[model samples]
Target chain A: MNVAKHMLFPDVGEGIREGTLVKWLVKEGDPVKEDQPIAEVETDKAVVEIPSRDHGTVLKLYGKPGDVILVGKPLMTVGEPGEPMPDAEEAITESNEKKVEVPKKEASAAPERILAPPSVRAAARKAGIDLSKVSGSGPGGRITAEDLEKAKGGALAAPASTHQEKTLSFDYGKGKRVPLTHLRKTISERMSWSWRHVAHVTYIEEVDFGALKELRGRNKPKAEQMGFKLTPLAYMVKAVATTLKQYPRFNASLDEEKAELILHDEINVAVGVDTEEGLIAPVLKNADQKSVFDIAKEIGGLSEKARARKLSLDELRASTFTVTNIGSVGGVLATAVLNPPESAILGVNRMKDRPVVRDGKIVIRPMTYLGLTFDHRVGDGADAARFMKDLVEKLENPAWMEKG
Target chain B: MSRKKVFEAQIEYLQILDEKGNVDASLDPKLDELTLKKMYETMVRSRAMDKKAISLQRQGRCYTYVPTEGQEAAQVGSVMASKKEDWMVPAFRENAAYLAKGVSMRTLFLYWMGHEEGSRFEKDQNCFPVSIPVGSQVGHAVGLAWAAKIQGKRQAAITFFGDGASSEGDFHESANFAGVFQIPCVFICQNNQYAISTPRARQTRSETIAQKAIAYGFEGIQVDGNDVLAMYVATKKALEKGYAGKGPTLIEAITYRIAAHTTSDDPKRYRDEAEVEAWRKKDPIARFQTYLKKNGFWNEAYEKEVQEKAAREVEEAVKKAEGFQANPEDMFKYLYQDLTPDLRQQMQEMKQSLEG
Candidate 1:
């Protein structure tokens, strides 16, 4: 069979100079995909599972387990099955070939040559004591019944913590105390840190959702056809992203060490999704760069992923701001704690038809109370007011969102 | 008949000091003892820093680093020729050049450790951040020189590149622009035999990179890149011509990359160990140290002091770099003067993900 030989080198991680081959996942003549795990390499950073850089059958194994491989040095040769192995000049010759021939696999299935007699073995087996682990004091290191008795109390004893007893206090009423899961722990730590560090200021404003409701009605069918349910939160995300361009300070994080405000350039909005377990926010990346319809579709997909607990790490990271739609749960107004380093969070309350005077006349309008919580260290009250003013305008004039 | 014998250009080779530490007194620039001592110390410090960076990369403390092991004389000598007010434009391999321009070792270590603050130089430093894209900084150097000329500033610009960069369109474009405008710029191509794995022979067919400058209507000279005095003399003369409005000068420093192109590269795959061994004998640091010892400017005690001082400084820099805490938000902060709507959302999304 005609075949082209390609060398496989160690590219385990960036800045890694060399690594020891811990084990080979694929052997000679095994088929491999482009990203299939072929070997495990231990570098200074970590033990990395190296994926194949090409698709072919492994023609030759250049380095065995425990062999040190330099970063650019070839670790294997991959080619078609039954291809002729490269000559001595190209492949790592002589020593490596001899080393490969020396089998390093352990004879794991061989029964242990125990020195105990049949009666002693029977007794030890009955007592559940392993005679192999006991060092016999008898002649030629034979295991006696006495040694077995001593070993029973030593090696195979149960762990200490499993049976430890503790005194209970019944002063308080009986209740079930459950430990926090990983997600809950993360939420507690982050919220506590944010609350302790940030100097928060909450600004509440009433936003007219009449234009957004009309836009949502017009686009709901089209959104459903695209396989997603459209909601007002999508318009809110677009408005926040669009208004962030004008009020960049609100989309900034304060670096306490450097004492500088870091303004982000990409407007990625994290929508808070209420799941059965807890609240999880999945990010819609580059919200301003996307259309309202696209944002709506992503919001639907992300919320589903969040609820299913299948959201990938990339989908949940690098968000510049957050929008919590408390409006769906029927809240008049609610203030959200600032997500640390994010500077602000927008809490959208429920929209309702309320009587208000626009031009000296009583009018029924769909209005919602929007609460903006910001870090006072990063921006002032005026900055927050100006930001909300721009956001409110964009939400009220929702036609502008359709264009871009 | 009109095309007969119109013009003839020749490239001059300059070597003030030999590999054996012998100097041609007539060609010596006669730099003061203090300046000569400082030059040697800078080269030593640059070598120490390069060594430390490579070690750090191997230990997983630093990122992929480009070592300036063999090109110290080329960088330091050229920088010594220019004034502090002159702008310094650099390619990625100019660690020694940055050191000579007063850029702290901590800043350099921080940069290699993947911090953005590493590139933030003080306003008076007049040094640009290390340009990773090969040959791209050539245009910036020319532009800076042009800007200075227009603003009636008395300063010039010195740009450092490699032999690999000479083949880039940016290099040729910058040279043509500088020559046409007679801008105050000095281009130093540290022709250290190999650019990563590609050797000088494969990089170009030209007999010498310096000769390419004649086509653009300017002077070009080749210097023994290992000879510090020769490099300094060539750069000083080029800077003088630039200040006199005589356009730009290209100096080709013939040296060898004694170490691998970078910490990630293995030169044994493409180069002969014998060649590397031979070049190691003509080591720039050794040659300069020899010259200093012969002139009585360097003694055993002084050498010990300089080495210890360099080690201490590099250690301090490493500690500072490791201790630095970079805010994750800094990634988006420097992209623009203010965050765009899209970027603002992106930053928020990142914060949420991390906090969550």
Candidate 2:
């Protein structure tokens, strides 16, 4: 008997739940070869072509190019027409959610043997727990959590079964184990991937505020007259932009397979803004060239738009660099990990005028603290230090634009 | 311990200056001469900064400035009680508290200048940022201080807000957290006579804002915000006790907002000249200056030099601030650490639109 086949789902990059059929490479009734391009599907991140598994005549087309097909599900069926298809139950696995019955138990029963994945066997053995004796709570009495618990303590032997149920309880209980969507799953994998791939080094430093205070002062009135509310955020943007120019490499991220640093030429700075929906980063492209006034106007507009949840998907994607200032409500310095694909992020803290030894005199200066977290793959301790120092220098000098 | 502690916690109120501007023997021992002198300086400096900020606003140099001109003693006294590592969370009106905490005049000026970059404070300074949104900072303080407790930093945080903040949900949230965790936090409510134009009686039915601390399972006290020494003593005690793991403290520092709500608001519209004159009589800086003169601690020469030096410092700060490139883009710059996909597209579209 020959095995029949249907196209199983493919792993499409980006946070796409379902893929849209852009075009079909094969037509219905077309004789398809194994590993052939079946169709192109468009996802949130990119468009990718689906591949067929086995050579067969296309018996049926379940969907068209315009339709979206979920991964791990059947897209089309193919089988030989010369012979009635053998019970190739494996072919319809993507669609089958019920028991595949091998129906009659033999009259002469061989001792019930566990037919399961090897990993489950190993897991049971590791616990010094046997799956042989206990009745499996799985479909068709498959060995599962309940079976494992029964094996742990024979019903006649121990009273520990109640509390011991945690180890043996494999059922979804009365609850459900729903599958994760593409976006949420992507978020999980990325967060974990960052933890695994990047060596997050957080270095915090305190800055004196005397200059910041003076700089803010001389500009506030004029800014207001200019119809912009001069805010500490604008000043921070200035400092970060100046710092980025000095240490351009901090703006670069690593290309995993190429094992090379992709240093972006343009500086597209992203600011994490809190909106009604969630936290979204609205980028300011070419920030280096933009004047503070332009920046302020853009900020006011973007924040309003962000708060209104009117930002398009594109506005959230274009950041080569980013800054999250949690200091709005006066937070002390906070450590943050690298936002994937970006080499570093600067965490801005609340401003406080604390006592400092300025020019060998104990004077009260307004101070801000910052914590920078960068990817070790693209940076070293020295690189981070240099970057931080540059940022600090910019903040310390409000007249930086004058010198520039 | 519970009842007595509760009563003692309520004893932090301060208002009148001592005969010579020194605390009573029982109270003076709580603050030494140096501490007292430092308190006086901070109050005066905060006043000077506020005055400068107001003038800067008038000169069409900076944005709207919140002047803590009449409430200096209240902010300075209570906030200076914090340990360097302890956090001071401030509402927008806590200008004097900001100065007392040591935020530089230049940075404060930058903030008033409406530069977001100016809001970026130094990294190691354990303080929450100045939030323009009223009543939001208190909750942040509770959360931050709770984090400190979890990490065993043993450093508490004190949040500053005006009586207006009492109406915000953050106040209740922070107060609840501080009490529940027994976290070292002090919610310093500067009960300046008004919230913009809303009078105290119209604000809440609670007899005293400090008494509200009892509902949250911590100590609460009413402090005379005008009395610099009392403010200092009470704040110091709260910090010490909080750090010692006693619990959080809610302090209602009763003071007056002699200055306008900001450079934009006209106090004359809501508040009468009689009210202003009455409050002017209790000027925080002048009262302390008078008390300092009465005692041997300060004289006419020291006062003259201090005032002159302060004015010069303010003037120089203004000059430096004005000289700095008024790069306005600092506003849109620092938002998120990294941009999401959509932001890039919008930025591109915006650039093209602007350029085209």
User: In every candidate, what fraction of the native interface contacts is reproduced?
Assistant: 0.02, 0.00
Superposed Cα deviation of residue B158, candidate 2 (Å): 1.0
DockQ list for all candidates: 0.03, 0.00
lDDT of 2 by residue, B10-52 (tens): 4445544652455465555344567767877777777778766
- Interface Cα RMSD of candidate 2: 31.6
- lDDT for A91 (candidate 1): 46
- B310 Cα displacement, candidate 2 (Å): 1.1
Instruction: Using DockQ, give the best candidate's number.
Output: 1
Off by over 4 Å in 1: A1-18, A21-404, B1-3
Candidate 1 per-residue lDDT, tens place, A1-404, comes to 66545454534356345676667999988888755767766554245556665678888777666566765556667777667766645544423442312112322455556798888899888977777778887755889877776676555565633343444867766786555544666689999899989998999999888878887888888878877888888888988988888877888888899878899988878899998768898998889888888888889889988876666566777889999988786767888987766989999998899999989999999989999999988888999999989888888888887642
> Which run of 10 residues does model 2 chain B get worst, by summed lDDT?
B1-10
TM-score of 2: 0.45
Off by over 4 Å in 2: A1-404, B1-22, B326-329, B345-356
What 10-residue stretch in candidate 1 chain B is worst by lDDT? B53-62
Evaluate model 2: give its lDDT: 0.72
Chain A TM-score vs. truth, each candidate:
0.58, 0.55
- Using lDDT as the measure, the top candidate is 1
